[model samples]
Target: MSFYKKDNSDYLEQAFYSLQGQTLPADEIILIQDGQVGADLENIVKKWSQRLPIRLFVNRENIGLGMSLKKGLELCSYEFVARMDSDDICHPERFEHQYNFLKSHPEIAVVGSWIAEFSETIEKISNYRKLPSDSEELFFFAKKRCPLNHPTVMYRKSDINKVGSYFNFRFQQDYHLWGRLLNSGFRIANIPKSLVYMRVDERLFNRRGGIRYFQIETQVQKTFLDIGFINKLEFIRNYIIRGCIRLIPNSLRKNFYETFLR
Candidate 1:
């Protein structure tokens, strides 16, 4: 099950191609279209549906992403759920690799992978690769930002339900949801492989990007506070240290972030 928007037709094609190339293709692909925005996703789905079963949940009203994801989870008929974004390319072996890994390590509630982030101008500016392995390390990595890439996550359906599913109307729902899951004693793991190509929208380089990131960070910190994971001082320390890099000049930040951190 996946939530997608329009205006990302080409990326959607790449996504479908990846899914089709998977060793174990999805039995049913449920796409949650937020609303009909003059983007003919239905037509594309129709063309692809002949080869694979595609079920689209079109919302008459424009529901937020968090709600759409929750709705998809509720409606999914599978035991496991793999997440994909409308504008990302998944690796051909993503499903097979994650599925096998999860089967071998049943203790993990969620599994994610590294991703390569490309600019719309076709330059690979940054990468978001995860650490080698260690659930605890992954947990620590998530303190400042989302350690797990959303598009590369595959999780147990029951585990999500155990945590009460996705938070309603949360802007940084993924981050907040991860905090809740960890607090509830769920473990997260990452495969040391790049399984997705993430595309950075050009607009995200502007003021709006800063605002969105700030909102996500605020919500993330609030979750940690509410769960008693960190005190005020600790939260402040993490906030400053983690976001300090973004304060530097963009060129330097981009180089450092991509070369070292990733």
Candidate 2:
């Protein structure tokens, strides 16, 4: 997992505590410090390092999520890597379930699960993101949206590397990665249960809009078209749909996410 300057110390502690509570605990937990995440978080990381099997890697400068994950992926010494966000809470059986699923289904390279979205507390989950149940549905669903919940995923390191791993997409890095994975014939699936409580608020909706974000979204769509994941017509449709969603007022965009995307 990767953390930045804005991550809450208490949340980071809770996230790590969840990992510690896992039934199938991680062999090596890679915690990448994206830039300088301040002293309070650093102290928490240092404390957890002594408690959990955390292998810490510090970045001298702030490098965004994609590059930070790329670094973390390189540092990971295991075959399968489960991803967790520093501010999110995981169910105790998440790792065990995903690990077993991977072992039983060798054809599937990435396995994710539903995520419960909470605002301030994990206790009061406000929304749940239920994804397509199998790889076939997930591949088709990728034409318009991200098929898997990013924070709820455990993927194979070798497969992720084979597809060129993560890239530098600022707004929708996971979506872009899914496109390439699906296009390259790698299979992905989602367990039909929620395994993570993802923190979300108005900012989550706000972060997905605006002119610059729309430009990046367009670029991602173009990349999809070039990769043969989507044809020219579907690309135009996605552009129009995304344009409406991204260029709209923030309140309307929030409603769009709530009414449809979630």
Candidate 3:
């Protein structure tokens, strides 16, 4: 996994601790400092490396998360790659469960699990679970919005390479990448289990983030249209639904999403 740090060193440490307690730990942990300069982060890195094989990648200038992930993937020596954000915590059996599933089932190129949301207080924000398991169900949902949780996904290195690396400098690289992967005839499957804790709030969808998401959604819709993933009438339905959701008040939007999108 690749981690980028800033003043959120505390949460970063917590994320690492969660990793340390994993039932099946990663062979290597790649930590990237995306131009975050602080004594706290350095100390945390030093402290964690004593027990785990942590490789540190430092950026002289700030690069976006997409670039950070690409860099991490470039340096990864493993066949199966899993993603974990700096603020999220993975379940103790996350890697073990995903690895075992992938090992037993060779057809799925990418796999993600259900996710739960948490606030800064660590309280459950609300319901945030999804239940589309195979490619057909996942594509059914993806036609409308991102059905995969970015941080809870694991992909085979060869499959990612076949599709191409994460989009460079894009606003919603994960969302766009999923679209392209589906477009290319790859299969996606869900583990049917909650495996990670995600943090969500108003800041996650402020003006800038809102605009970014809209751009991604538009691009995804266009891609869907291009490949006949959905008819014009269905596209119109999804476009209006997504547009209206984007316009709702942030609090109401969160509730609407938890109720309907999942």
Candidate 4:
């Protein structure tokens, strides 16, 4: 998991607590300290070290999500690596289900579950996001969109490395990786269970908008086209749709997303 300066101390503790309470306990909690997150957060990490088997790595300079994850993967000891957000809450049975599933289906390279998006607190779940269960369907879905919930995924490290790991995409790095994995014939699936409670708010829509994200959307669409994951028609259609979405008002975009897209 990766955390930066903006992550809250209480939320970080809650996240660690959730990991600590997992039914199938984690072998090692590989926490990436993305740049300097201050002394208070360090104290939180130090406190959790005694309870959770944390493998902490500190980054002297902030490298963002893609590079940070790439750096973290090299430090991982196990074959299967589960992705967790520093502030999100994972259900106690999440790792148990994903681990068992991966063990049983050795051919599948990645597995992710649905997520309940909450605002304020986990109990205040405001939205839900679900993905296809079948590998073929999910692969087709990846041609136009991200195939998995980033934080809810458990992926094979070797498979991820084979596809060049996580590239330095400023935005939607997981989407780009999923596109590459699917294009390379790596299988993936979803459990159809909401195993993670992801925190989000209206600010999410704001982040998705603005000039930077709009530019990032264009770059992502172009990346997919260059990778052969999407054809000319899909490239044009996706770029236009995402650009318009980014250009729209945040409240309107959120309503449109929750109403039709989600």
Candidate 5:
């Protein structure tokens, strides 16, 4: 599944190329246009539709990522669905590795991999986002940070549905969903290797630190507390730590994230 909202023809083309070029290529690609997009983006999708098994869903109005993914999940025909972002590029062996892991480990409900963060090109990776590989560690990690890289995850559709599909959240939706799944007794893990190239630039850093983003972050933490996934102490600690990080300047925040968080 993938979602896009604007003119991203180059990224969309590369994403499709990477997907179709995968060693264990995706059986189907569900591309959701969250709202009306540019003609270039539409043309690119139209071109790929003819070459790939892509099912396009165009929302008349912007519905945000969570709703877009929720709708995409309903149309998936397979048991396991891999999530991707419009601008990210998956490794050639990403699907093969993830599928084999899931096939071998039936107990796991969701599996994600580390991602290499880059600005312009994959070769110029500026940072790496690593994650815990076990359920226990992931559970603890999720209390403070997002345990799974959302765009690099391959999750079981039945398990996601059982825990309740994606919520209508503006930010940290993946983190919130993972918390729900964990509370519902689903296991999550991550591959140790980086399987995707994640695009991260100054804009991403700025977006993550603003007041609007902090509001959504606090809301998600409160929901986790209310659901019994996190205790009062954990909630307070998370708020303090995350709030402080978000209050810092963007340059400092980026450095802190690259040096400490990741």
Candidate 6:
């Protein structure tokens, strides 16, 4: 699944190229237009539709990522759905590796992989986002941070729907959905190796701070608490630590992620 909101001609093209390069190609690509987009983006999609089985869905109004993804999930024809970002590049063997894992581990409902984050180019990888590989470790990790890389995940459609699907949250949609899945007794795991290259720049770091983001973080934490995924003490501790992390400089924030969260 992929979603786009504006004119991202260059990045979108690279994303599609990565998909086309995959050794185990996708059966169908579900592209969601979250809102009004440029003609250039439409043309790019049209150009790729000729080569791949691309199913496009347009949302007249901007409904945000959660609702947009929920719409995409409803249109998926396969049992397994792989999530992809409009700006990231997946490894050539990403699908093959993930598909084999899920097929062998029938009990696992979701599988994700580590990602190498870069600034301008894939060769200049800045850092890696490493995650736990087992459900027990993932459940413990989820109380404090997101246990899975959202864009690198391949999940069972039936399991996600059984756990109430994606919710319409501003900044924490993936995080919230993972919590719900864990509570519903679905197992989650991650591959130790990197399966995708994630794009990160100044804008990505800058988005982590500010009062508005804090409010959204607090709201998400409350939801987790109410759902019994987190207790009162854990919620308060998370809020304080995360609020402090947000208040720091972007450089320090990046370091915090690498030093503590990763």
Backbone clashes under 3 angstroms, per model: 0, 0, 0, 0, 0, 0
| Residue 177 accuracy (lDDT) in model 4 | 86
> What residue runs in model 4 are displaced by over 4 Å at the alpha carbon?
none
TM-score, one value per model: 0.86, 0.98, 0.88, 0.97, 0.97, 0.96
Candidate 4: tens digits of C-alpha lDDT, residues 98-179: 9999999999999999999987888888888988999989988887778899999999999999999998887688888888
Q: After superposition, how far is residue 259 of candidate 4 from its true place, in Å?
A: 0.8
What are the per-residue Cα lDDT tens digits for candidate 5 across 1-262?
5555563789888988898889998889988888878778888999999989999988989888999899999999999899999889999999999999999999999999999999889999988899889888998888878999999999999999998899977878899899999988889999999999988888888988978888889999999999999999999999998899888999999898888978
Residue 1 lDDT, candidate 1, scale 0-100: 43
Q: Can you list the residue pairs that collide in candidate 6? A: none
| Clashing residue pairs, backbone N/CA/C < 3 A, model 5 | none
Task: Report the alpha-carbon TM-score of model 1 versus the true structure.
Answer: 0.86
1-262, model 3: which lDDT tens digit per residue? 5555454778778889889999998999877778866788788889988988899989888787888888888888898989988888888999999999889889888899998877764455555667687878888777777768889998898888786778763556787778778878888889888898877766764532255566666676776678777679878887787777776677777667667766
Runs with alpha carbons beyond 4 Å of true place in candidate 5: none
What tens-digit string does per-residue lDDT give for candidate 1 at 1-262? 4444545666677678778888878888888888775446666677777877778788888777888899888988998889988777777889999999999999999999988777652245455666546799877777756667777899999999888888753456787778788878899988988888777643443322354566566667877887876679879886775466545555665555558766
Best by lDDT: 2
Top TM-score prediction, candidate number: 2
What lDDT tens digits, residue by residue, belong to model 2 across residues 100-178? 9999999999999999999978889899888897898888889988898999999999999998999999968888998
Task: Give me candidate 2's TM-score against the actual structure.
Answer: 0.98
Better of 5 and 6 by TM-score: 5
Better of 1 and 6 by TM-score: 6
lDDT for 35 in candidate 2 is: 84
Query: What C-alpha RMSD separates each model from the true structure?
Result: 3.0, 0.9, 2.4, 1.0, 1.0, 1.3
**Pick by TM-score: 2 or 4, better one:** 2
lDDT of 5: 0.90
